[model samples]
Target: MTLTHTSTGVLEFESLRDLLRGYAGSPLGMGRIQHLAPSLDRDWIEQQQQLTNEIREFRRVGGRFEFAGLLDISKLVDEACIAGAALETTQIRDLIMVVDRAAEWREIVMTPPAAMKNWSAVPNISEGIADFTAFLREFRNKIQPDGTLEDRASPELARIRREIDKQKRTIQESLRGYLRRLAEGGTLQDELVTIRGERFVIPVKVEQKRRVPGVVHGSSSSGQTVFVEPIETIEQNNDLVRLLDEEQAEVHRILLEMTRRIGENAEAIRNAADVLAELELQFAKARFAEDYSCVPVSLSPARDAASGAD
Candidate 1:
């Protein structure tokens, strides 16, 4: 028998209508990503809400004066997604795009449902969209139209801002005190320090277990090693932790007190931020409108007597 292999080169011609029929077929039902979409959106929304609160609180606490420029909501969102914070609507679209482009392996390529379920899910474009949306809202309503603040409702704002400055200074001074105490105390006894920069604990090796005779200890995923000593050492370790925990509690108390203080004052921190944001917008608008003059400023046209005399 002659050796022959039949090549099925016949390209089957199915109707184009049939080929395109279920192209948009979804993993779930008519709602498609219904289950995953809301969950992702909620996560994004909650994170955004928390971040907004933190920013507002930071501003209320006088962090705005220290840092230049308002918080970029879009950037924050992008960072959150990159840091595996949450997903956005556009991100789902991107996922779908990738799936569509996979050509042959489209079905095999995992969807958002699978990707989110995985323990090691990474950040994606969804975060960026969420942030962008926030920026849009803030820019349009909270930040843009107000411009410079008039003296009308400023006394309350000014008082709160002054209080924030004072409170921030107190917090800084308190932190310094905590740091000084830690330096004096040496080795945290009761508390856990986040273990920063060098000075990491290591475990004893098996071969050298006799010379370096120690117990098997917990290790960080980054391969940084940890060791556990006797309870005697633990007490010493915990003292610093205890002090730090107390310090943290104190700090929390201080923050609460400061917030309360602001609350006590006529206007809240949000009102103060609104004033500042309005002022910023007004200043920018005024600067844009002002005509350049070498001799005199258009907005504030006062010339010093000494300079005029010269």
Candidate 2:
């Protein structure tokens, strides 16, 4: 039922709403409480009462109902709802958790405990939920927890990364060897392998800079040494950068495909959400009633004051 801002304040409904909201398990559940109001619709009120009573009765008979890991996926789902939208690795990870949590909740609710009775009254929140088992398994296998795709994610990616590793090692070993030669000749400033302008280089004395035969990247603040990228390593550095770019492109491809699959299953997800939200809300109502010592009383017209119904 709708309530004007003025009327709600006068009736002190905010306190009651906050009390109920405290029992919600997640943002989505608390959102339902935010809109909670006194109702005049007899059918809606009775239906809500029946659901809460059902849960409370089951609990009193040694049954438990707790919704764990119920996140508000409305925004994340919206990001995925658009066609051709590629969710980032972290976003996709969060979305995957939704599948797992929803599945866990579904299994527990559908397969009630042996001692549980009158479970027919409990809503089937898992009804029409899509089977995401296969997709979930595939995603886990291809994506690492660090957000990088596994070598087996794609053959091309595997090949590119392997080559990238090889090129990096080659550049490092070559730079270190050159640094050692310079040190032996007394032509080195620090004899250290460092990065200069995104390429491997070694610190050399200004007087020996010509001996190193490379482009100057930068000089030390004191002007005692210069950082240079050895000419021989330029080609290798370029190759490594190219390979890294390729790896990034392949990773994007994988994430885009996963997002598309999520989009395809959006309908089933939305349906499950509707039922789960209602299921969670009812369970919260039952807990609130028990904690507050609330009891359901029948509502009917007063024989003496017919207009009191207003």
Candidate 3:
């Protein structure tokens, strides 16, 4: 079937598309709205109308549906297909969110209101959804919303972070003690311990730099004070830095593993994404109908003839 739109018809479709876009919950959904057009296939139009009618009835009975994290991950998925490619923490998190939202939507449709159950029986609506959801569970506790690996992401990471924390506390305590001694001796420029260039240091009077017997990292503007990393705490600081580096490496490994797992399921993930996008478009159309009190208009023979002439 051939479908053609005149200038006026195109304008009207654009206006409707804009209205539907407003109801879309994700980028994928909005893109679908932007490409939406009147279909010449009678079956396709009838199916769309039926879906919208079902959604309207579901909404009227206080049914609530929310879709989140529908960002397009096609680029990331494409990247994942490359050899030895790893997704960043945030990218993996976003993918997980997409899978999670898809699962939620499927569950809702599978258990629709009794009055709408038959309408919800769209063939293969939940296909591959469960597998994608199960795959995402591996990352549930591993990744944080901010795209950082959680301490619980791996036992090695937890251990490294714990050691890092211990070393930090030890360094802080030793630095405090040194600060107290310098203050007592009246050689300290400031009573506070601060960090300069990632090294914990104390400010000491410039003339008393010899008394501190440490590395002079920086000097104050007036040259009256110098930031010194005391020799006594140098070992602890080194250990802390080493532990921090190890923590970072462990987090990277975890992210790599997560991304590899996602890559393994790339096809399934893509399918799930397509299903979720389709559901979002249907829901947007249903919501547009609800908000605008829209009913499907059948073209009578006369109207059809008139449209043909135009």
Best model per TM-score: 3
The C-alpha local distance difference test score for the whole of candidate 1 amounts to: 0.30
Error of 3 at 165 (Å): 0.6
lDDT of 3: 0.78
Once superposed on the true structure, which residue ranges of model 2 sit more than 4 Å away at CA?
A: 3-7, 53-71, 144-146, 185-211, 215-227, 279-310
What local lDDT score does residue 84 receive in model 2, on the 0 to 100 scale? 81
- By the lDDT metric, which is better: model 1 or model 3? 3
Reference-based lDDT, each prediction: 0.30, 0.75, 0.78
Using lDDT as the measure, the top candidate is 3
Local error of candidate 3 at residue 212 (angstroms): 2.3
Model 1, span 219-244: residue lDDT tens: 44644334333232334334444444
TM-score of each: 0.28, 0.77, 0.87
Question: Candidate 2 or 3, higher lDDT?
Answer: 3
Per-candidate clashes, comma-separated: 15, 0, 0
Over 4 Å off, model 3: 5-11, 120-124, 205-210, 219-225, 299-310
Worst 10-residue stretch by lDDT in candidate 1?
A: 28-37
